[model samples]
Target: MKGKILELLKKNKGDFVSGQKISEELNVSRTAIWKYMNQLKDEGYEIESVSRKGYRLILTPDVLTYDEIKDLLKTKRIGRDILYFNSIDSTNSKAKQLASDGKGEGTVIISEEQTKGRGRLGRNWVSPKGKGVWMSIIIRPDIQPIDASKITQVTAAAVSKSILELGIKNYIKWPNDIIINNKKVCGILTEMSGELNKINYIVIGIGINVNLDENEIPNDIKDIATSLKIESGKKVSRKQLVANIFNNFEELYEELLNKNEITHSIEICKENSAVLGKEIRVIFRNKEIRGKAVDLTDEGELLIENQEGKIQKIISGEVSIRGVNGYV
Candidate 1:
């Protein structure tokens, strides 16, 4: 109801809208309209209510309040149910719990500050309070468990596209990352739950350093990670950024769900990837492979050419990337 009123006021920009007319249009009583108007006011919307004229909407805050993010998001379902937390251990953990409880699909957990955020390979992410975006998107795609890594590719495109839409120069690092000026701005991790043949749920975790101060960063990550605020000289609106990400994701993820084009999507991922043609040292559990990043196989495996001219394909495992600084 408040959203409809907002659209009406925004449509009439700078014009006064009467409460009676709004109520008639929305088929709600004048009291409900007044209540919703107060709700908008509490959400940092500048609305002027007068005796004669109904209400005049002024401005929208740039913060990541639920109300502010709801309208900006144009997705059909992915962001329709956003659970935001002021502080949490990990959105990924919460999203998993929600998925396990069968709350429903398309459930998303977003936090401006994650207290114990975990990154890929069990690393601790520098997700301080209100400094970055720590979000987990729960998806139950109709694909198998092994093919679930496709979500990483989907997120690569979504996150990279969102950053590009901001007009800042950046590129997608292969597998799961967005890098700018040779520093990591975003990291993605895709986890899944499934049986041998059937699939249950998947959680795609995304973390972006939106507007963190240099002082807030720990000494270890200061040199490798950078935020939009540090690069653009201003704090990027977390609400706007998160909305853009989900809005873009809705299009891509929906297409993937409809077609199940796992192979095609992985090919698209390789084309936009910056990991190829670089010298990288891959660290596995027991042995390591050092070779030139040659290409990705049809099954989303990394093909590395060793010094002996041997082509080794790695399908699944953690990759300790080295030799590429621009797109870490």
Candidate 2:
């Protein structure tokens, strides 16, 4: 009911709609309309209430509120059902819980900050309030468990495409990182729950540094992590960025889920690859292999040729590729 009222308020953005009219249109009492308007105000929406003229939306906060998102969202799915949080432990964890609770596919879990944020290899991710895009996308694709890893590739392509649309020259590092000027601006962690042959659900957690202050960055990774503001010298719109990501991701997801194809995403990753044709060190659980990255397989595996001229197709592992002869 409140969502319906907010939709009405947004529809009459700059102009005021009478409380009586709103009540009549929404089939609610005038007091109910007043209560809902006050609730929106408490949620950081600047609403103007006049004597004869009812509520008028003056401005919306910069937060990722549902009303703000519904205005810009264009995808048919992916973000239609969003679970927004000002702060949380992790969007991925929350997304998994919702998926388990039978939430529909394409539900998105987004947070302004994550107290227990994580990255690939179980490392801690620094997510400050209003600093980045911390969100997880819930997917229930029909592909088998073995091919589930390709979802990460799809997410990488989506994020890289979104950044490139902003006119930033970025590269997709193998497996789950986006690099610009040799520093990482984004990371993705793909997790899933499934049986041997069937996947129940997959959660792809994406974290992008957007406008974090340099001082807020952890000293341990300050030299290697960067934000869109730090690189572009301007504050990028988080709302637009998130919307763009969803649009791009939805296209690729439809291709993968409906067509059983990852060709487009694979092509994007290869075109913007940061490690291909470069020397790299692949870190596995037991051993490490050093080689030259030759190409990416159609399934998005990293193909590396060792010093002994032996080719290795790595389906999953941590890779350290030189940006300019050393770590970025």
| Clash number by candidate, in order | 0, 0
lDDT of 1 by residue, 1-328 (tens): 7778888988887778998889889898998988988877775679888888878878865445555688788888877887877678898989989988885677789886788898888888888877788999988888878777767877887887777677666666667878776678999988888888877888999999888888876778777788888887887778878888898888878877887664554655666666678777776677878878889775567789999999998765545456444424
Could you give candidate 2's per-residue lDDT for residues 1-328 as a string of tens digits? 8888888888888999899888889899998888988888877789999999788989877777556777677789888888889899999989989999988889899998899999887888989998899999999998899998799999999999998888787999888999987689999999999999999999999999998777877887877888888888888888888888999999998999788889999999999999998989888887888889999988989999998999999998878876553644
Best by TM-score: 2
How does model 1 score by TM-score? Answer: 0.82
Best by lDDT: 2
TM-score of each: 0.82, 0.93
The regions of model 2 sitting more than 4 angstroms off are 323-328
lDDT of each: 0.79, 0.88
For model 2, which pairs clash?
none
Q: Which stretches of candidate 1 lie over 4 Å from their true place?
A: 12-38, 48-54, 64-76, 85-87, 128-131, 232-240, 316-328
